[model samples]
Target: MSAHSWDVRRLPSAEGRSFLVTGGNAGIGYFVAEQLAGTGATVILGSRAPAKASAAARSIGGRVPGARVRHVPLDLADPASIVAGVAALRLESLDAVVCNAGVLLDHPPRRETDNGHELMFATNHLGHFALVSWLAPLLAAAPAARVVTVGSLTAKSVTLDLEDLQSLRDYRPKRAYARSKLAQMLFGFELDRRLRAAGASTSSVVTHPGGALDSLTPSRPVRSRTAGELLRGLPAGLLVQGKEAAAWPAVRAVLDPSVRGGQLWGPRVLGLRGRPVPEPVRGDLADTALAAALWAASADLTGLAPAAAGPAGA
Candidate 1:
């Protein structure tokens, strides 16, 4: 099926299915969880703060009656948190896992995660990589499952440095963030290839919430409301989009049964603010050599098997 034919607003029923969304406390992640929950899907929100997650869950419940929204404390900056978060899921089955948690704010002076990897790389790419690796069995248990890794438009401006995968040599905030996003795009497509080769039913897809701003999120949180006003006051509002609209591509990528593995979706207009559609991937993002190197590096850093990285026992 083509992306032009799909309507993000007309999603299929999600009753009886289960999904896990990282960073579900606020922003586009919260709205994604809200949209899925409104359709009767049970959403497990992975958040770093228990209070925020609980509050987000309560907000979803209030907005969508009978919505099943739960929270698991997930700190992407720490490898231990990822392991604990997976374990906290209690080996339960999942239909999809939206790898949406990311650190967009550029941390100057180069921060490192608990596992000693670059902070942005660790949180944006490696943490999700580990979560998906650990949850492979659960995803395979489902008749059909998907993994949606959120990519970024920033990736188009930078190429990943395989040798300096962690950006340890010269750590510039924006460069590291862009490289990490590129890694996510590469890892996501590579995961699909590996999953297909392994004959697994689970598919891996990537998407970018084009020009989404926290300042425009629709939730009733004080921060969102205040920022929403601030955003409207600025001239950038002409180009920026709300988090709800920005989430359409990701929502489609996750729930659109017609969407295939390795496919990427983004805003149709200017690849920034518009309806969700299939956007062209960067040429270098599809380089097999880089993909392989990234997969190997991810496995080594996360201490998982290279070939058995994705869904198992398909």
Candidate 2:
């Protein structure tokens, strides 16, 4: 469908398909899973907390009757957990995997993962890097698979420092978070280039959830917003939107047959609040050299080989 004609309320059918959404138990990820579940597709919620994941799954089931939803234990900051999570999935093939889980620390004392990498960089970029690498074979096994990388608008304002990816030298919370997201966007674009060159059937697409506010979101079993909170969020709602709306870009990227690899999708109005639509990749996001460098660094840090080339539609 054309971008102008695409409708968020009416999604394309995804019957008999399966998708894995990292951090699918809460926030925008939870809504993404809920929306996808409405299409009759099996939605696997990759989360670290079993209780939260179960609650999110029940919420989805209640909202969409007969919706197929399950959870796999996943902690993006831990490589061992990622491996175990992927292993635990029973599916022989996956239609898509949304790299949506991320961390943004507001205040300061820098934190590191057990692996010794910065928390934001490790979880936001490297964790997904490793997960995708491990899931590569399953993605290749599908008729046509998608890897949707969720980026951030914060990335547009900051430049990635390849030498200081972990932010050991200058550890401002926001900047570090932004740079990590920038690195992820670079990885998505670079992965698509490599997939095309290798004739792989899998495609990498990047998307951003413009500006989502929890206060503006509709209530669910997993998260409930009080009337007072909604009232306070009214003014901001004119500019931004709720987390349910934030899931649009990622959902469209996953289900829209016309969406091609290396393309970007996001909120249509001012790239902030409205229907999801195709958006132009700009500035550092379009830099091939930087993407390649980031890809090499990611591979080295994660100790995963570059995505293997396979036959188209393999």
- Each model's number of backbone clashes? 0, 0
State the RMSD for candidate 1: 2.5
**lDDT of every model, 2 decimals:** 0.83, 0.93
Reference-based lDDT, residue 275, model 1:
81
Compared with the true structure, what per-residue lDDT tens digits does model 2 show for residues 1-314? 89988889999899999999999999999999999999999999999999999999999999999999999999999988988999999889999999999999998899999999999999999998888988988899899999999999999999988889999996999999999999998899999999999999999999999999989999999999999999999999989999999999999999999999999999988999999888999999999999998888887787784375221223
Deviation of model 2 at 112, angstroms:
0.6
Candidate 2 — which pairs collide? none
Candidate 1 residue-wise lDDT, 47-146, digit = tens = 9989999988988888889998899989987877877888888645789999998886556788887668888899999888878887887898888899
